[model samples]
Target: MFKKLSVLAITFVLLLGCLPMLSAQAAGNATAKQPGNSNPLMDHKLGADPFALTYNGRVYIYMSSDAYVYNSNGTVKDNDFSALNKINVISSADMVNWTDHGAIPVAGANNVNGSAGIAKWASLSWAPSAAVKKINGQDKFFLYFANGASGIGVLTANSPIGPWSDPLGKALVTGSTPGMSGVTWLFDPAVLVDDDGSGYLYAGGGIPNTSDPASIASPKTARVLRLGADMTSIVGSASTIDAPYMFEDSGIHKYGGKYYYSYCFNFSGTHPAAYPAGEIGYMVSNSPMGPFTYTGHFLKNPYTFFGVGGNNHHAVFNFNNQWYVVYHAQTVAKAVLGDGKGYRSPHINKLVHNSNGTIQEVQGDMAGIAQIANLNPYTRVEAETIGWNAGITTERTQAAGGPVSNMNVTNINNGDWVAVGNADFGSSGASSFKANVASATGGGKIEIRLDSATGPLVGTLNVPNTGGAQSWQEVQTTVSNAAGVHRLYLVFTGSGSGNLFNFDYWQFSTGGDGGTTPPPVSKVEAEDMTLSGTYAGKITSPFSGVALYGNDDAAAFNQYYAYGTHNFSVRGASNNSSTARVDLLIGGVNVGSFNFSGTTPSVQTLTNVAHATGNQEVKLVVTTDNGSWDAYVDYIEWSQ
Candidate 1:
């Protein structure tokens, strides 16, 4: 949505087919395998290594979040180790808008962040990739990644964003592993499972693709292994791939019964090719372990359309029978800091293939691919799950606990909002809205808007204080004709103060637009009210108690009563036409202020008083001079 009007308005007449242009003079050509067609997609935070999964009509992307510290010149400072402490998951039905599901927590730990600031495997924590498999009739996700670039580690979880566990309890493939003797550059792990439930792993680096030539070793290899059914260990010995100009970041996949192996290639003089060094090249083979035929360049972004960061890594996935390429670019960091060292983001584009099985030269995109479906808002949706946001950032939900994540977007100041794009309200339409929220201080209002932010106001639910930020409660409000396709915006409006409240999740219902279900409440009479302290000197009984403006601030009410309410009617009257003010006190907190300056001496009502639910002392204190500061309380009552 931040794109220029020219880019936004331009409709691309994309070429729909890829031609197999195999390199005729290629070195190390084995046998031709197959040709193929194939998001910077995220905006909340920067991420790289787009391991894409097309599951149940949705694309779930796993990413390596860059937590780099850059200097004034844009170069990373210190040890760039901390940024890879964790990984994150984002998903989408449509290609343009994506939902950030927060950091993917390691099952037994907090988003890979352990006690203090370190993770169990901090070093090999960069470039993440994963594959989903079904075991025992249920789907399971196997996540593979490099740990500090030293070894390959695997985590197994039931869901993509995990409650995960270290499957092997150590690096699955280490330098100590038999065939991995001189292959020191073992990182950027990619994993995929085939139609028959068989899994494969691709990894290796260090020797040829390093910026520092000294990091290259003698036996630099791009290694592939037949993963066991468990997906944690190798089935047998690893096979070596002798691809011409194959560098780091090996991406492998099976499409149309053909296996495609892709990697980064340098634009060096010795390796003459169409795509430059900072782009990508791929080869194909009939077998999983490729005695492969080197294909020409497939992807090249010599000058990043997103910005200036190198090291091309990518993944190809399909949804609704259409193929796509997901790659990382260093755009946001460079655009923000004037330098893009140690930072990168993800982007996606459609890939079309020729009848001969060769992939089209897929280019990068800015507005990105099309969204296949619309989001539904009548169901319970996670608050931390966002398509896009403004003036807000995600944080730990609380101290990391069992299933409750430490990663929920908090610190929502006034005028801030989060958008859930293209929510389908269905044909019936929605009549109401409900949200789970908590406030440490008091509360605020949630303005529900459809389509654009300043569009129609569907409803406004006034959120009440729920003890603390971690204390959760559900509040409902009414909505109007909120039907059809539109972007759902949860706009927070409070006293422009500091942090207002923490939001959990929200849902719209066809009914219950009449506010929340009523809670048990009772009415207390004036004579039934208890009074504290001795104020007889300035007080007299008209029927009950009356008091003149007190010279002393301490001497006040007779007794205290306990009560709780969101709002209630206070039955009382002011003494005269002069200005009369009183503070309604509850639970050692000033619950409300009532001004009956010009009202007559009749039973009156005060409503919508927001206060906590608990039995506590309720005392009324006189403030300012107004007709001897006297008012009679008949009965205090509330519906909920």
Candidate 2:
């Protein structure tokens, strides 16, 4: 999927009749591979060579941006891999709904930052592999990408979806690197951080040129090298692996105390019964740097699953204790353009391991894996976290004082909307809704709906002119009859044409009196609370003027309110530790807790907490010390 192919124009025009049939199918139908059906992940854009990274409770996927090329006459041209210079990042706690983090400007002249890429010397970036390692008490992320099959470049960031930078300012692996001799096309890197805190890198693909044709069966073209303690440098020279019928895409994973070295078999010559052409084959070994034995093929070519075959690229990883494989196909492009023209989009399917340590054959199709967890609507959710979307696009922009960059739902017009799946609004239901929005032009209305885009209308938020597009304002509206687990939709409505407004994030409030009055949800900013403990202090961020951060730190809020069961939620960041947690105490009695993780600030809730009426004290105490003990708390909300 990383390489380019030439397609005839006549063949493309002849396949135009398939679009009508595809469009006629219902979205929820099993045969349809649309956004709601969960096949190609997303249909708005194209991406390929998907690599997965699991941190905390989320799975982040890094992909090579697959923008469609065009002929001079404005017809779609074949994907030539020349326009690929950026990497797309998207993540989800639930596998079905994903949050688009936009693209990382990796190479070439015009990056997303308006200058040269993070790696200015590289011209192309493709087939990215991402890994996270703990260094100097904090998590450091490393991204290895192919610089057009000639070399591999590395970028480092503090977060998975990064504001990345090239630490070395050049390619990390080149043909000149030691032990790279006899290696053809030194790219397609797969990295592993072993359980022992050691790192290993696997790369190098393509068949060797020789007079003896049998060399195709054992190319010996793949290389394995030990990564230094810093994970940016090499420990020693590289070592070669004799992968049978190896072509491209070097994949590695450790399971059942054994190292699995997998690759895509080459299509150049005749293959044996054991090795299949253009399919993924694996070899097993006891060590990361291995004298390995060839196993069996698990995944067939994309043609077997989607009927549109090209080169296959894949990554295997474990998320939420379940094994899954992410690969690319031309399904989305073929449905829209009638012919795929070698353009590709990413897809995921479940992978199973037999008790004997052998992998079960994977079945790849339009139906993807089930959602591992339900989404919490009571917290602030990014508008880009979409299960399905229509007539809209996302862009990376800087909020007034937020992170370096944040993605927002944009390019919205009338009849456009975004949907989120399996949102648990609880038995009490939601009473109100809030959104962070902005607009330079006349603003529009956001209709909160259930199930489908045109489903039941629960509430509506009228957006106003916010001075500028980056100027954000929090707006709220009363909600009614929004309860239980169901798909949530934010439908945009407006007058005139072009983009109406930009949506950053949204949250819904529960436990209000079902009436015309607004929900009785009370929010207390962290900085305004009384702080105690040795390390507790206030910090500043874009979302809040002051936020609380510390280990074993406690913040107390004393207020007079009605005695009843209420939902308690907090907005915060985990300081890059999965074990971060905060205990909620009402009048000095522990009621429930809120868990935090990942670098991005999000909201987590502890619902149905009993509070006594009259003046009472509520406290939040950080209980975990695994990370830097620098976890943050932006605000706490109580809704009844």
Candidate 3:
């Protein structure tokens, strides 16, 4: 199972049956305040195409899709995809403590729309919408999804939440409308049921049409077609609903005699400088079927409440007479030259329309409003080590047990080392701590112990040193059997006797519930390389030796030599991808790998054990997915 580790503080609050009326002006100015609610009524991550349905007096917000894996250059990061691609439902009766209904509309499940595809960058599923109404006078739930590359599919369930399935292999809209012919990219299907039991499906995110006057040559426009009473097919010519800056996922709401079309504009694409950061915008149409006008940038900013990036891809809906806007954003620093892909988060805020008539993007994060039981034993922190012989200190200052800070080894220091010991973490259990380290220095080793454990011999580990310093290798260990406010110490026991071997910071974890399950290792062979899928050039290792490689500068690569984990030598080869992508595949399945983009590669290891017995066929694949840049594999290894 994929997991997401968030660092925000957690809290809980009981919801009273009241919502404070938001003022339009105040709502627009309601920047996310610091020390905000821990669990705001509705907030999501990497979420898009948000669809909301009020059932049995409770409100459930569903996202059409979300994604966890982030790719840069050619390196892929192992991340939680539960919040993306799969369907997640969060529900609340009092607007607090929303329940996560895991994944619904799961691919390949009974009644689901399509078959699950292989690990493609943007596969699985996309935008989702739900419609609940009386079918033959009995209430039924209709779940709509955009499956595969472009087809709009449908599923049915008895309950609002569902184990929805689509027995038919093809999409209803594909067969119903003649205009949706050939292979086309039309997704994000929003279904609106009319008074007479008929419904219209609004499909969006298509290439610009040049024939129509209203058709702006932008990647945002909706393809509208009415559906028959059975909801099986389209009812008319594929009429295009064009709007000013109106492109991408859109929500259609019928209000006081007019149709309010809320659409998302790639605010990042608005200016040449802002061509990558997306933001939400809105437009209004007197008729859901006609011309719409661009309103304004709903919520466009350079930074997030978490000091990351702004939000985009929104959905707005009404629950019990209250209108709410749902969207996504990233809470991390962004890349200047991205892979043309945007980072996102799911968000919800009460919709406050201006007296003059306009809608704003949701503001004031409610993520701070709720509390959930934390299952993690120890908190994890990511830190950077700079300069030569750098030391990061983390004294036990909090009530809980954890490392005070992290240490990184970026400069070559054959004589440098780390010193770790405990300080004021009031004595608890036999205070157990663990450290995870990575380097390419073959002879690197770690000497660790608690001040209360025993003699100078607490726990010592020697890094397997041999591979080129260009690639990073890793070692994970747990040190225990200590008492009192135990001090855990980490000292690089030099190549032999002195602090001659330098290293990155030793990561410390106290009382962490991190599972002991090791990651799976995928084995690949040199024969697996095909001209189509393989990186252009290759490295022939002389004799029996292991090679390593990554996207790192000479300075960072040189520092690994003093760590004594793997050898500090590395060879560079050409490839392209935002990050350095390392792949080890067994039967074409990726098992061990490391990915790095923009910043220097994180100190980690890709473990492929086939080389241990000298029976492994290794094929290294590099990527140049990003258009402008290229790089090389850092090094290789020979073992037996």
Candidate 4:
């Protein structure tokens, strides 16, 4: 027998260090790329379940802000919560820069209907899907999202973000009803406005952990319900749309004569970091809601040929006729480097439509950039609860944090107030306060008030303390509602110098819809046509616009520059009819403008070209042109 082989202990040590090494290498790779070279037409982390619309030359991104929390690394902090089940609109131009339009109010806190306050599911809002079309004689938007903690609910407003109201406060599609208790009713809504201007909603994808593992393995049982034209209730029996495997965060796209269902599996919806992350795949059907047949996959592990991980929560948005995919990538080394938190940063990639009209993911680039048409208006803010002590007194107080408890600060003299809490109350609701103070002298009292943009004394209360180790006294009061939505403060006022008190909690209950939110819009206007340009070198295949040539000889392979009306292109190849092997740039950034060449010239086309807004510029450069054998392009027309 061969000498016994011992697994080297040294090998184990090396393997242990592999994780840190790999992590460091990954982080370093992201930073090694040329800065500002590979960027998206536009980008942002403000919206989720991104729904986009291009109307009258403007592109708007509609989504829910939900809640604001620190990424584990603590790099980003803000109060941009959708403000109580509200929808937010962000508009952009060039698909690069964006502008936050604020929150689109569907419902606010303490409203007769909708979810708000300290309720379990009321931290922020959830998925919001939007469709814009003309109803009657005027243009209207149908924005749909689930209300309550877990079931499907309906709210309507003429605009994307609005003073939305639910005439019926019950679940539009009941979740886990008596007969359906086998599963937890879930809601991640996606809306489709058909050619007839009729609206149809597709919702489902939540599973109760109580189910047997075996039962969960079967995808056929997963539900996908269809809503009628009104979208107020369900139509036909809830049907299982995605076949073969159950996938959540589903989106629908109709091209040519078929409907494609883009979805992701392995997403648990709760802790986004749950194991087994997910993979992006699609299903195809002849109708909007169908017994979709799972086709091939789209996005998988960008680093490995066979490994698939971290691609979920997706949407298909089109700006100026060009399609793009907005999805969360599991891999975000930037956030990891910045803070060590791993929640993936949002990503948007250009999409290609197959000759048959099916969509494909653009490839080659691992990272892209995004810009906005306008700046997000809300000021980003963060607050942490801290312990407070009254001067020379053994009295200390705990900060009441979160929505349920009213925040308060105490331990001060009369005419003196102190801030005990910090948070941007970005909605309409009642301000709550509670505290107690010990009276150092007779007639000593503690008062509570608010000092905010619209405040000086929101509402006050005089709470008397009976002195000496007395149980904390309660001070209950509600502040006035501010006009629109703005930051709010909770203040504690007390009487008698040197007298201090302790605050318990403070919160604001949103009332009515916070206010209006418009989708991000770009200042640039759509260009009417593409312009001819020159090239100085050999261009990559799958390029757009015109392939410039240094000499009319035309056969030259170098000095080929390509130009296009838009900044989107595929890797190795394209699906539209533009040019290939041309160099393109956006503000000096070399976002890939060409694809690899193989066989025939790859197709390239442009959509949503912006009109020359005085502030922006578009340039195309060519290095070499591959003549005859593989034709190069010069420019494209608006109509292709």
Consecutive 10-residue window with the lowest summed lDDT within model 2: 13-22
State which candidate has the highest TM-score: 2
Q: Write the per-residue lDDT of candidate 3 for residues 327-428, one digit (tens) a residue.
A: 554431021113212333345666767667766544545453221111111222121211001122111121122222222332323333322222223234
lDDT of 4 by residue, 1-640 (tens): 0000121121110000000101112211222222232222112122345566665334666665433344579544422222335555644444433333445445544552244322232323456677765433234555666563355556665654444556455556565532223333355667777665456666555333313443333344345555565556566666666333343566777777677776555433331221222445677888775767766566543233212222246677665456777654323233334421222323467777888655565552534533222111121111112211112111223322222112233333434322221222333434443333334344343333333312455556555554532334444445454323222333334444444444333323332222122212222211222434233233444343233344321211111212122323322222233333544444443332343244344445333333322233344444332332123443322210
After superposition, which runs of candidate 1 have C-alpha atoms over 4 Å from their true positions?
1-39, 68-81, 105-112, 116-123, 208-220, 267-270, 398-407, 513-640
Cα lDDT, all candidates:
0.60, 0.76, 0.41, 0.41
Which rank order by TM-score, best down to worst? 2, 1, 4, 3
True-vs-predicted CA distance for residue 165, candidate 3, Å:
2.1
What shift in Å separates residue 178 of candidate 4 from its native position after superposition? 12
The prediction achieving the highest lDDT against the true structure is 2
lDDT at 410 for candidate 2?
82
Better lDDT candidate (1, 4) = 1
Shift in Å, residue 186, candidate 3: 0.5
lDDT for each residue of candidate 1 in 1-640, tens digit (9 for 90 to 100): 0001122221221010000111111211111110010135644467776779765445788876556565799655522434554667776656544656666543222444544323354443657788887554346788887775577888888866666777566678887765666554687788878777799888885344334433322224778888888888887777787655545678887787888888875333343445355567778889887776777667775245654545677888876667888887656445444655445667788777678878888877565665444555654566766655555556656523313344555667677677776676756677888887878876888899886556689899998888988887888888888887787878887884667888877777766643343434566655555544344123333344344243222222232222222345555555565655556655455544555544454443443333433455566665544234554444555542
Scored by lDDT, model 3 comes in at 0.41
Which 10 residues in a row give candidate 3 its minimum summed lDDT? Answer: 12-21
Ten contiguous residues minimizing lDDT sum, candidate 1: 13-22
